[model samples]
Target: MSVTGAITSGDASLLPGKRDEDWRWTDLRGLIRQIPAASPQGAAWAWESPLAQAGGEVVDVVNGRGRSDLDVPAGGEALVAWRFLSTDGAGAHNAELWVSVGEGGKLTLVESYEGRGAGYLANTTVNIRLAKGAKVERIVFADDHAEGVSVVDASVELAPEAAYAQTVLTHGARRQRIETRVAHPGAGAELRLDGAYLLEGQHNADLTTVVEHLGVDGTTSQLTKGVVRDQSRGVFQGRIVVAEGADRTDARMGHHALILSDRAEIDAKPELLIFADDVQCAHGNTIGALDEDALFYAQQRGMPAEVARALLTHAFVGEVIDRIEHETVREAAAGWAGQRLEL
Candidate 1:
C-alpha cells in the first residue's frame, strides 16, 4: 500500500487523535488546516559541513521526497529508500528510510528535514536495526521554515550486546512533532536518546519517545530539553516499558522546559511501565519559568536580565548538547540554538 494510503487507512497507527494513546496530548487536527495540498516553490537545498561527511550515509527528505548521494556501506542489508507525498489537502508527506546493520558492524545514519513554504507538512520516518555486537549512531536535524509543519518518527531495534544512540535537534516551526520508539529484542543491549528543541514566535514543537525493554539485561536512558519564547509552545512526553520477562533492566527518562515569556507555554509528561519482577525504572518532567533568584543575583552582579535568562536557558539545553559525541555536530547545534534565541 502507498504511504499516504496507509496513514489514511489507519495502518500507520500514528495519526493524531484522542483514540491514539501516544498522540492524545498534542492534537494534529488543528495543525492540518494550515497545510496545503499542493507543494510550494523556492525550496532551497544546501548541505553544510560536518553533516556532509562521507563516512556515514546521509538521507535528505524535502517536502516528503527522498534524495541521497551517499553510498551504502558494504555488506549492509535491508536498506529501503522511497518518497511519500501528501494527498487530500492534508499538507503533509512522509518518507520512511530503513537500514539494517550486520553483526559486529557499525553504521551511522543522518536524516535531514527541510521545507518550502507555508502550508507544508513533512512527516518522515527512519528505522534502524543493530545486529548482535553491532553499534549505530543516528542523528536527526530539522530546519523547517517558520510556516512549515513537520512530524518525524524514528524506531530502532537492538540485538544482543548491541548499542544504539540517537540525538535530535529542531528549530521550531508553525507546528513540529518528533516521535521515537526503541525496542531491545535481545539481551544485554543499550539504548540512549538525547533531544533538544528551540521554539520562538508562535511556533510549536514536541518531542515524544517510547522505549520498550523486551529482552533481559537491557538498559535505556533519555533526556530532552526545550526553550520556548514569545508565544511559542513546547511539549515533551516520554515512556519506558519493561516487559515481564525483561529482568535486570535499567531505564531513566527526564524532560525539562524553560518558558521565556508569559505568553509562552510548556507541557511535559514522563511515564514508566514496569511488568518485570526486578527492574529499576524512573521518569520525571518539569516545566517552570526563569529563576528569579538567579536572575536577581546576576543582575546584582551587573548582568542584564536578558543576558541572565539567555545564559540559564543555554545551560538547560546545553546538558543534552554536551552529550553529543561529535565535536563539530555539537558546535553546529549550539550555534543554531544561539541564533534562534538571538543570543
Candidate 2:
C-alpha cells in the first residue's frame, strides 16, 4: 500500500524507505523530514488534455481534489480520461480513486499525472475491482516537474475470466514511483503489465509491481524499459508468486534499460517465486548503455550523431508505446514520448 510516497498522515516516520523490501531502492522516509501542508484548494488549475478533444468523458482532479469514482455496469462499456494536475504551490496532497466493473463490462481508462511547479509532494492511490468476464485496459502518462516528488499506487482484484492490461509511460521527477499490486484468482484470468520511463537531469522514476496467484490457470506477462540521461536514475522491481495450488500458471518478467550519461544509473530486480507444480515462470534483467555497434551502424548510414542516438532511443522505447491497445491514445502517447525524446 505504501510505495515510497510522502506520508499524508503528516508523520514522516510512516513513509516507506530503504527498510521496506519493495522500497529499498527508494528512501522516502529519509527524504522528507516533515510532511508538507496540503496544497491550496480551488486554485486556478486550468488545462486541456489532448485526448479529451478526441473522445471519452474527462475526469479531472486538480491539486489532489475532485471527482474520483468511475463505475461500469454489467455488460456495459465506457471510455474515460482521468487527469491529475497540480498547482504551483510547493505543498503536499493525496487523492484516492475507486473503479469497479460488473460482469462482462469493459473499460478503457486513460490516466495522466501532470504536475506543475517545483518542490511539491503528492500521492495517489487507485483501487480497481473486476467481476467475472470483465476487462480493463489502463494507459498512464506521467510528466512531473523536475523538482517535484510523487507516488502513485494501484491495487487490483480480478475474478475468474477477467483480464487487466496496463501500460505506463512516464518522464520521472525528483522522486516519482508507480507501484501496482494485483491479486490474480488464476481461473483463466490474465494480466499484462508494461512500462516505459525516460528521465533526464536529476529526475528519478521507480516502477514496482507484485502479482500473487490465488488459484489455478492464471497468466502474467510483464516488460519494462527505460532510458536515463544527465545523471537521472530509474528503478524496476517485479515479483510474481504462485501459491501451492496455483497450477498451470505461466508468468514472465523482463526489464531492460539504457544509460546515456556516465552519471546516470538504473537498478533492476526481477524475481519469480513458485510453490506450485506444472507452472512455467521466468524473469530477465539487463542494464547497459547504448549499443555502440548500433550507433556506429546508424552513423555509417549518414545520420548525424545526435540524430542517430535519438533515433535509436526512440525506437527502443517504441516497443512499449506500440503495445498501447487504443489507436487514438496510442498515437497521442507516441507524440508525447516523441517530443520528450526530441525525435
Candidate 3:
C-alpha cells in the first residue's frame, strides 16, 4: 500500500485539519504541502540513542520498516527499547509498532521518536495489548529535528487485572501531535497516562488522548504539563468515558500549561462521560505564567533574572519528566528540558 493509503482512513490524499474538532488547533492538511512517499527498502541507515541500556533489547525503525523481533518470556520480566528515526528529507515517512504482553507477564517498553530534517513529515502508529495479570510501564518521547513535522497515534487495550502506565515528553518541532487512545475492558484494571511538553521558537505541539472504562473496578489517571515560549503553541485534549455497566470506575484527568511569552498560546480541553452510578470522576485545567513572587525571591538571593526564570521553568516541567522510571531516559529528558529552556 502507498504511504498515504496506509496512514489515512479512506482518502490518503486528504489530511485532517481545522474542519475536524479533534484537529482544530493543529491542521495537518493546511500545514503539510505534500506527504512524502515511503522510502524504498534497503536505504542505508544508522541510529544512535542516548538512553541505551545494558541488557535491554533495542529495536530500531528507520524510514518505515524495522525488525519486529520480540520473544515472549515464560515469567519474570522483559525490557524492550524501540527507537524511531527519520531522515527522509522533504518526503513523508511512515512506521508502525505493536507490542503484546502475555498473562502474568511484566514488561517495560520505551519508545522514542527523533528525526533529522529540513522539512520532512513522519507518521507513526503504535498498538499495545495487555493480557490478564499483566503489568507494563511504557515511556514515549518525541523530539523532531529542525523544521520537521510528525504525527503519532497510539492505542492500548487491557485485560482483567492488568495494569499499564505511560509517560511522554516532547520538545516540539515545526508541528507535532501525539494522540493516544486507551480502553480498559477487564475488571480491576488500572491505567496511568502522564505527559509533558517543552516548546519554544515557532514550534507547535499537541497531545490528545481518549480513554474508555468498560469494566467494573477500572481506574485511570492522567496528568499533562506544558511550557510554551516564543510564538509557539501547545494543545491538550483529554476525554474519559465510563460505560453504562462500568461500575466502580475511578478516573481523573488534568492539564496544566505555563506560557512564557505573550505571543505564545496554550489550549486545553478535558472531558468526562459517566454512565455508571457508582463512579468517581473528576478533571481540571489550569493555564498561567510563572509565579512572580517566586521569581522575585530567587532574584533577591543574588540570582540573575534570566537564571531565576530558567530555574523556575525547569522545576515546572521536572514533575513530569522525573516520573520516567529508567534512570538514563529520565536524566536525558531532564537534560533536554533544561537545554530547551537554555538554562
Candidate 4:
C-alpha cells in the first residue's frame, strides 16, 4: 500500500506539512515520491555494538520485524539494536517498539536506521516506560540511502527518581525527521538529551523534541548541534513544558549549528512554557559558520587548509559526540563526522 493509503485510515485528513506548526520546516507530502509495499523479512542485517563488552544483551530488528532468535534479558543492563534494512525499489517500511524497564534496572539502547539503494522510505515509533529508580541510556544514529526518506517518533515516560539520557548522531539523507516526546510524572526525575547532525550534498535532517515536566523537583537538560554543507539543510526544534504545580522544575535547552557553505541552511527553534512560579527554564539557539580566526590559527601551525577546516568543524560538534557513553559508538560517530567533513 502507498503512504497515503496507509495513513488515510487514520485520523488526520492530510499528511503533516508546512501548514502544521510542528511540521512547518518539513513537507513530508512533497518529499516522498511513492511508498512501496511492505518488504518481506529477509536475512538478518549485520550489526555490532560496543556495549557488548559489558555483557549487555543485544536485540536486532531487521526490516520492520524483530529477530526472535536472540534472547533479551529482562532485568539489569542490556542493549537493544533497532535496525532498518534497505529495499530494492520504491517502498516504505514501518516499525513500532515498546520498552519497559523494571524498578532499579538499567538499560542502554541503540536505534540505528540505515540501508542502501534509492527511493525508499522508513518509519518507526518507539515507546519507553521507566519504573521508579530506573535508569536508561538511548543512542540514535541514522545514515540512510542517498535518495531515501525516513521518519521516526519516540515517546518516553519516567517515574519517580528515574533517569533517562539520550545521544544522537546522523548523516542525513534526501529527507529525514526524528522527533521525540518525553514526560516526567513522578518527583525527582532527571533527563539529559543530546544530538548532533552532519549533512552534506543535498540532504536534509530535522530533530524535534518536546519534554514535559509534570512532577515536583523534576530536572531536564538538552543540547543539540549540526554541521551543514554543499547546499544541505539542518533543522532543530525543542520545546520544554513545566506544568502547573510542578514546583522546583529546572529545564534548559541549547541548539547550535555551523553553515560550512554559503548555500547551506540551518534553522533552530527552542521553546519553553512554564506554569509554575518556582520553576527555572531557559533556551538558546545559534546558527553560524566556522570562526575565521580559529581556522587561521590551526593553519598557521602547518596544518593544511582542509585539515584545519575539519578540525574546527569537529570541535564544534565534539561536545555532543563525546557525551556518548558507548566507546564503539563514539568512534563510529567521530569517523562519520570526519568523512562528512571530508577531513
Candidate 4 root-mean-square deviation in Å: 3.0
* Global fold similarity of model 1 (TM-score): 0.85
Clashes of each: 0, 0, 1, 1
lDDT of all predictions, in order shown?
0.70, 0.89, 0.81, 0.78
Query: Among all windows of ten consecutive residues in candidate 2, which has the lowest summed lDDT?
Result: 1-10
Instruction: Indicate the residue-level lDDT of 126 in model 1.
Output: 68
TM-score of each: 0.85, 0.96, 0.92, 0.91
* Candidate 4 lowest-lDDT run of ten: 2-11
User: What's model 1's overall lDDT?
Assistant: 0.70
lDDT of candidate model 3 versus the reference: 0.81
Model 3 stretches with alpha carbons more than 4 Å out? 1-13, 40-49, 69-71, 74-76, 88-90
Q: Rank the candidates by lDDT, best first.
A: 2, 3, 4, 1
Best by lDDT: 2
Candidate 4 global TM-score: 0.91
**Between 2 and 3, whose TM-score is larger?**
2
Per-residue error for 284 in candidate 4, Å, reads 0.9
